[model samples]
Target: MLAPFLIMLREGVEAALIVGIIASYLKQVGRSDMMPAVWLGILTAVALALFVGTGLQMVSAEFPQKEQELFEALVGVVAVAVLTSMVFWMRKAARSIKGELHASVDRALSGSAFALIAMVFLAVAREGLESVFFLLAIFQQSNDALAPLGALLGVAAAVVIGYGIYAGGVRLDLRRFFRWTGVFILFVAAGLLANAVKAFHEAGLWNGLQETAFDISHILPADGPLGSLLSGMLGYRDAPTVGEVIVYVVFLAATLIPFLAPASPATSRAAARPARQKV
Candidate 1:
C-alpha cells in the first residue's frame, strides 16, 4: 500500500506540474481561449490510460497460473526499466522543464488548433502511459484492493497540491522533492527487479541459480505483513534465491551510486539561483 501510494503520488504530481505549466503559459500569453483544448487533451489522455490499464488487467487475468507468473515477470521488468529512465530523465530535464514547456506552448499556439490539441495530448499521454505501466506492475505485486485504494488517495492528494500551486497558495521545492522521491523510486525498482527474477524462476523460465542464498524464514517469513511490506518496497526476502539476491543488490548499487553522488558545483549553483530568485 505504501509503495503504490508513493509511486502514484509522485507520478501524479509530475503530470499535474506539466499541465499547470502549460495552463499558466497559455494564460500569460493571452491565449486563455485555447484552454478548453488543453483540458480536452488531458481528459483524453486520462481516458486512454484507464482503458489501457483495464485491458491489461483483464488480459492477464485470463492466463493460466504459469502464464500469469510469466506475465507478471514481464510487467515487472518493463516497469523497472520505465521507472529507472523516468527518474534519470527527470533529474536531467528538471532544470529546463519550465523553459521547454513555454517553448512547447509557443509552438502549439503558432500552429493550428489541431496541432495544439495534439501537442497537449502527447504531453499528458506520456505521463499517463507511465502511470498506467507502473500501476500495472504494482498491482501485480500487491494483488490486494488496498494498494489501489492507496493509489487513489495519493492521486487525490496530488490534485489538491497541484491546485494549490496553480492558485498561488503554495510553493514547492521541486528539485528537492523530485530528488528524494527519485531515490526512493530507485529502491522500489530494485525490489521489482528481484520480484521479476523470482517470478521467472517460478515459471521455470530460468533455473541456473535456484539455491537459497540465505534463510531468514525463522525470523521473518516473506508472507508476514511486515515482511511483505519490505518485500514490496525494498525487495526483502526471507530465503531469497541466489539470482534474486544478485539482481537486487547489483541493480540497487549501480543505480544508487550515481544517484547519491553530490551534484556538480555548476549544477548546484544553477539550482540555487532559482530558489534565491524566488526568495
Candidate 2:
C-alpha cells in the first residue's frame, strides 16, 4: 500500500512539475493563450494511462496459472527497468530540466500548435506511464484494496503540494526530497527485481537454482500483518530462492553504488542551489 503511494507521489510531482514549467513558460512568453493546449495534453495523457492500466488488468484476469506467473514476471521486470531508468533520469535531469523545458517551449511556440501539444503530452505521458507500470507491478504482488486507496491519497497530496508550489505558498527543499526518495526507490526496485526472479522461476522459465536461501517463515510468516507489510514494501520472502537473493544483491550493488557515490562539483552545486518553481 505504502509502495504504490510513494511511487505515485513521486511520479505525480514529476508530472505536475513538468506541466507547471510549461505553463510558466507560456506565461513568460505571453503565449498564455496556448495554455489550453497544455491542458489538452495533460488530459489526454491521463486518459491514456487509465485506459492502458485498465486494459492490462482486464487482460491479466484471463491468463492461466502458468501464464499468469509469466505475465507477472514480465510486468515485474518491466516495472523494475522503468523504475531504475526514471530514478537515474531524474537525477541527471534535475539540474537542467528548467532550461530544457524553456528551450522546448521556445521551439514549440515557434512551431505549429500540434508541436506544443505534443511537447506537453510527451512529458506528462512518460511520467504517467511510469506510474502505471509501478502500480501494476505492485498491485499484482499484493492485490490489496488499500493499495489503490493509498495511491489516491498520494496523488491528492501531490496535487495539493504542486498547487502550493505554483501559488508560491510552499517552500520545499526539492533536491533533498528527491535525493532521499531516490534512495528509497532503489530499495523498492531491488525487492521488485528479486520478486521478478522468483516469478520467472515459478513460471518455469528459469530453473537454475532451486535451493532455498533461508526460511524465516517460522518467525515471520509472509501472511502475518507485519510480514505482509514488509512483503509489500520490501518484497519480503520468508523462504527466498537463491536466484532471488542473487538478483536482489546484484541490482542493489549495480544501482546503489553509483547512486550513493559523491556527486561531481557541478552536480553538487546544482543540488545545493534553491529549487526554482515558477508558475
Best candidate, TM-score-wise? 2
Task: Please list the residue runs of candidate 1 whose C-alpha ends up more than 4 Å from where it truly belongs after superposition.
Answer: 265-279
Residue range 218-265, candidate 1, lDDT tens digits: 899988888888876776789989888899889989998888787798
lDDT of 2 by residue, 115-217 (tens): 9999998998998888888888898887567999989988998888887877779887777777778888888889988888888888989898779999999
Model 2 poorest 10 in a row by lDDT: 270-279
Clash pairs, model 1 backbone: none
Please give the TM-score that candidate 1 achieves against the real structure: 0.92
User: What C-alpha lDDT does candidate 2 achieve relative to the native structure?
Assistant: 0.85
Q: Note the Cα lDDT for every prediction shown.
A: 0.85, 0.85
